[model samples]
Target: MNWLLVVVGGMTGAPLRYLTDRAVQSRHDSVFPWGTFAVNITGCLILGALTGAALAGATGSHLQLLLGTGLCGALTTYSTFSYETLRLAETGARFYALANVAASVAAGLGAAFLGVMLARAVWG
Candidate 1:
C-alpha cells in the first residue's frame, strides 16, 4: 500500500517537475536553472505546510499518505537537481553548479520554514 502511494506520488511529482521546468525555462533568459529553483521552492513550501498540518493534529495518516508520501514526495525532487549540478560540473561551470547547490538548499529550506509559519499562523 505504501509502495503504491510512492509510485503514485512519483508519477505526479515527475510530471510536475517536468512541467515546472518547461514553464520556468520558457520565461527565463539565464542558464541558472530557474525551473529547478521554482520547483524546489514550491516543494519546500508544500512540505512545510504538510509538516505544520501534521504537527497541529489536524490531519490523519491517510492524509499524510496522500500529501506527504504522494504530493510532497513528488514535489521535492533531488535527482534533477543532482543531474543539473553534475552537468554544470562536467561542463566546467563550477561556479554555477555551486550556486545551484547552495541556492536550492537555502531557498528550499527558507520557503519551507515560511510555509510552516504561514500555515501555522493562518490555519491555527
Candidate 2:
C-alpha cells in the first residue's frame, strides 16, 4: 500500500536525518545550523531526482510515495531551518542568518536542478 510505503520510508528517513544531523553538527563549531541545511539540500536533491525519474518513466507511484513523499518529507525540516535563521538573527549573527537564507535557497535550487539533470541523464 502507498501508506505503508510512506510509513516505512519515514521510519528510515527520520532516524537517518537525526543521525546525519548529529554527525554533521558534531564536526562543526558554529550556530549556523549546518546539519539542518545539509539535510534540507540533500532532501531537495533526492526529491528532484525522484521527480525526474518519474518523469522519465523510470519510477512509479509506489517509489514516489516511499522516497519522495515519505523519505524526503521526513528528512527535510523547514521549521528547523526557519528557527535557526531566526535564532541567528536574534543572537546578533545577522550576517550568518541572511547568508543562510540566501545560500540555502540558491544552493537548494541548484542542487535540485543538478539532481534532475543527473536523473535524466541516467534514466532517460
Candidate 3:
C-alpha cells in the first residue's frame, strides 16, 4: 500500500516536472536553467508544507511517503541542477553558474521556510 502510494506520486511528479520544465524553458530564452530551478524550489516549498502538516498532526506517514519521498524525490532534480551549473561554468558562463547556485540555494531555502510557516499557520 505504501509502495503503491509512492509509485502513484512518483508517476505524477516525474511527468509534472518534465512538462513544467519544458513549458518554462520554452517561454524563456536564457540559459540559466530556469526550468530546473523552478521545479526544485517548488518541490522544496511543497515538501516543507507537507512536513509542517505532519508535524502538526494534520497528515501521516503515508502522505509523507507518497508526496515527500516519492513525488518530491522525482520532482526535484539535483543532478540536473549540478549538470546545468557545471555546464555553465565549463562554457564560460561562470557568472551564471555562480548566480544559479546562489539563487537556487537562497530561493529554495526561502520557499521552504515560507511554506512551512504557511502550513503551520493554517494547520495550527
Model 1 C-alpha lDDT per residue in residues 5-122, reported as the tens digit of each score: 7778778887888888899989988777789878888988887887787777777777677767787777767887899899988988899999999999899889989878877887
TM-score leaderboard ranking: 3, 2, 1
| lDDT-better candidate, 1 vs 2 | 2
Would you list the rank order by lDDT, best first? 3, 2, 1
Show model 2 residue runs off by greater than 4 Å.
none
Summarize candidate 2's per-residue lDDT along 13-120 as a digit string, tens digits.
Answer: 999899999999999999889999999999989988988898999999999999998899899999989999999999999999999999999989988998899999
Q: Clashes in model 2: which pairs?
A: none
Write model 3 residue lDDT over 1-124, tens digit each, in one string. Answer: 9999899889989999999999999999898999999999999999989988988999999999899989999999999999999999999999999999999999999999988998999997
TM-score of each: 0.86, 0.97, 0.98
**In order, how many clashes per candidate?**
0, 0, 0
